[model samples]
Target: MHEQNPALGLVHVLRAVTVEFDLLGAEFAARHGLHPTDVRALIHLLDATRAGTRATPGWLGEQLRLHSAGTTALIDRLERLGLVRRSRDTADRRRVLLEVEEKATELGWAFFGPVIGEVLAAAEGFEAAELETVRRFLTSVLESVGRARSA
Candidate 1:
């Protein structure tokens, strides 16, 4: 099989890699008493917004492949744990923004640290060129999969 169509043969390998990541994510969510989608939502929020930057439900929904109303509900749950808060955008009177509520990140790190560290360590030996290749491929997959989900 490889002798005939080797170039695209890696698609199956990529799918397997994606499945492993999903399994790890599911385990993390279950251990933390969260839905996998909720944890995924948290990741997207953390990625796009820093300590002081504002993140909105609309923005998060777009990024996380969730509906605006669903993002609001997930946020409501996170808010109960004092994870986040909704804010009115000062410059745009009618807009709402979500900002990291401080304690949430600290708490997340506590439960998530070991697993994340292990995953990072597993990839630590890759050369810079290899790492760059992996990053480029993975980012391309992320965008394609994300676009597919939203579509």
Candidate 2:
């Protein structure tokens, strides 16, 4: 309880959430015949697209902490699966960019749409101010994790 150690309780909850996500990710990987690293790469590409950021293989390599050969191999695997494609940047024809294919998005939504819906349904229980507080808390937690990763 908060009376004893609030931080420990929050950490436990976060850990539980992480475990659940990892399990779900594993299931998705198995069903799709993808390695965990492949799933992570897809997620990074999707996030970058959503953020309106151009995602290059080099950037993805950094995000995945992979060497060029590993990154190329991963990309090749995804491309062979038709889940990803390489495109030349129009602004700089020499630069290659990674793009998630529609099939990948459709597959991802097919698997995770219900989970997303449930999350939104649960969020509906909170008032605006309460949701704001939750957002702030989550943002701080993300920042802490980012700092720890860099350190």
What is candidate 1's local distance difference test score?
Answer: 0.78
lDDT of 1 by residue, 74-149 (tens): 9998788677788899999799887766776886788668878986997898888998998998899889887887
- TM-score to native of every candidate shown: 0.74, 0.96
Cα RMSD to native, each candidate?
Answer: 3.1, 1.5
The window of 10 residues in a row where model 2 has the poorest summed lDDT is 1-10
Let me know the TM-score candidate 1 reaches against the reference structure. 0.74
Worst 10 residues of 1 by lDDT: 1-10
Error of 2 at 59 (Å): 0.3
Clashes of each: 1, 0
Q: Candidate 2 regions off by >4 Å?
A: 1-3
Error of 1 at 62 (Å): 2.9
Q: Where does candidate 1 clash, by residue pair?
A: 55-98
